[model samples]
Target: MINACLLNDDDTLKLVSVAAGSTLPTNTIWLDVNQPDDEERQWLEKLLIEDVPDEDEMDDIESSSRFRVGPDGVHILSLFPQRLANDTRGVNMSFTMRKNLLLSFREDDVSIVRLLRYYIRHGKANIRSALDILLSLQDLKVDQLSDMIEDAYSTLDETADTIIEEGHVEENLEELVRQEELNGQILQALYDSRRALRFIKKTFESSLDDRQNRNIDEMLNDIESILPHTQFLANKINFQLEATMGYTNHKQNKIIKIFSVAAVVFMPPTWIASLYGMNFKFMPELDWRFGYPLSICMMILSAGATYLFFRKKGWL
Candidate 1:
């Protein structure tokens, strides 16, 4: 969007095309323009008596634009986490000239457009006013980080403080599930924190002044302070998840042991029957009248020996 702020005061408001913005009765004019048509750009071009900076030219504005044109100590092009790029909670981009005018062009940044409109409406679109607005935005961003982590810390702390153990089996499992949820939330918050830091870092990289740099550092510090706590919470979640897995494995092993024992207990009987079933004509044992009874006894003895062996080996 394109926003115009005329920062010419009554005493210094002199209209002489384009010169240095050293003095003037600043008249602030702010507008919100999105996808500015050719006609709109022409209008802006006429009003400013200067060419409008296109999005392409303004992509890495700090890199392309001169120090004089860029915001003091603040780079015009700052990278945000990819997540923020999709965020719709946009802020207004402000435009301010030294009591002269501010012409802002943002075809992709919606929040900046909103901010421009809000500040202009509130009589806060002058060059000084615009700087104030931007500072407030930085502050707001910092505040956002603080609030998000603060709430997170409190919730995690509460969970850590209390343990609900006496309930139905499902309840116990549900608690584990809840812990998983908490961890997920914490990870999300961490992602957000990182995103904000990236954005701040991008802003600082282009900054040409100390004030803006300080702002970026402040934001980074905020993220850093919470990192340890967030990391711990994440670790706690992982530990819990691992412990739950161990219990599940133990239960499975016990079940497998029971099945194995049953198989072993019947294996000896199976061997004895298979041996007798080999009814060859030259089999003396089979020809004897007591052979069948002897085979049965032999099978019982084999079964007993196998069982004892298994018991002694602690296979069960």
Candidate 2:
């Protein structure tokens, strides 16, 4: 779908749905193309005078391909955080910023885009030009990353408490793994945002005014501040995982130790029984009546002695 954000006469933004055959409005400051169909893609290509990158191209990891400055405008393919039903992931979106228009193309819906659209429609966003829209989107993305980090922190704290209390070791490990994955996603998003912003700053250094530069600088600083937390969380997750595994191994070893002690305590009784079971005619126990009772007593005393020895040495 293609939605155009037009700047009205009163400085407010109006979101208009651009139909397949419709021409883009002259006052449109931002053109958001989400999972565009073939017709929509052709319309956008004709309108922007450039071909839109496909999903595969947008997923490119090379910085040179991801960020480029050409005669047409600046092109940036940046990763954004997308929340799934059961988890979170990073989605790459292509941004093309021209003199008067900011075009964003994404294969899937991004939370930041939805949020920026809502803010613009609700008069909560202060957007003067296409650049403002881009900066605002980045700013909102940073805010979202911050919120995600805070949530990760809270989750880790709870997991740590559970570990310390020794409650549900398996569940705690699973939660920690999830948190690690989430934290890694957050870190990737932050790194992508920082790199995109840095590229924007360098590309538009001569064109950007004081306010835009300041916004970019602030976002960069925020990213820098939040990076350490991700590292800390990564380290904490690793430590907790190791500790949990150790605890699990300790429990397993205890069970094995019990079985080992039981085997050792019965060894002496087994030896006595084996000796009495011999079928040799010359065996002294076969001719005597008290032989069977004496063998039983000997077996009991040997087993008892083994048990006492183990208990005395604290092996029980």
Candidate 3:
């Protein structure tokens, strides 16, 4: 968890102990830390000779509303990681550059530490290799969100079309449930993307470099533009899920009602048969030769009358 990489000759980062005086090249040394504790936090501050902002300060740096400069050339670039309200898988990466040293802080476990170690050992340049790394990570999150939205878009489109073409969404119930889950994911992704962009706006210093500034701006716009659609699609998915559930319930109730009516229609016939089935003394069917035929006729007539009455009342 406390892996440190020192960028070395040949433009690479090699693994270095976090102990003091690692003798790292000032220009190539980059610190990649995950969920840094108080001790690690102090170490970075000691090395940089500047007050490293705590979590709150780190968060504040993202607002783009405040600007400050330190004695060293330490430029802070922090971007909130894209995450859902309840997501635990994604990590946030923050870059702090000062005195030709780059420091990264992340909550989610990232491979940046390994990458840095390779940079130092191999003397590779992380700045060039990792420029798109941040973008790639952001793109991954955005694409996942878009896929969920697009899936719902397709499913709802299909559900809508299925309702139009097949007259209703099939009774898989499982598919509808899956759609519900995807809706939650999509909604969460939208919020996460927005939160990340807000951080980008606050922490990004366009004056640092022209190309990076443009890249950040372009990524920000891309996130913002799709946000509205993401929200709407989430809502739409939720609505369709509710409506489909209602329709399924209605269909179930109708089936139960039919069974109830069938039972009602057979009630008279069952009653007649039960009443005459007794083997008591002087039973009519046992005594008279034609009694069986008469009883059967009476039962049939009663059943027919009951059915007719039900049909007349439109209860069939």
The numbered model that scores best in lDDT is 2
Residues 1-316 of candidate 3 have per-residue lDDT tens digits of: 4555443466544565565435444444445667667766676676665665555555453434123345644344434323344232334355554544556666654443444345446645335433333443455556555655665677667675454233456642455566666555555545655555455445444433666566667766766777787568657766776777777778889899888887886788788788888778877567889978987888788878888898899876
Best by TM-score: 2
Candidate 3 regions with alpha-carbon error over 4 angstroms:
1-24, 35-102, 107-140, 151-189, 192-206, 270-292, 308-316
RMSD of each: 9.5, 1.6, 6.9
lDDT of 1 by residue, 197-258 (tens): 45545543654257656665676676677667656766765665455556567777989988
Q: Is candidate 2 or 3 superior in lDDT?
A: 2
Candidates by TM-score, descending order: 2, 3, 1
Worst 10 residues of 3 by lDDT: 81-90
Please list the C-alpha lDDT of all candidates, in the order they appear: 0.50, 0.88, 0.57
Q: Estimate each model's TM-score.
A: 0.46, 0.95, 0.58
Sort order, lDDT high to low: 2, 3, 1
125-169 per-residue lDDT for model 2 (tens digits): 988999898889889989999998888888878877777455679
lDDT (0-100) at residue 182 of candidate 1? 47
Candidate 2's C-alpha lDDT?
Answer: 0.88
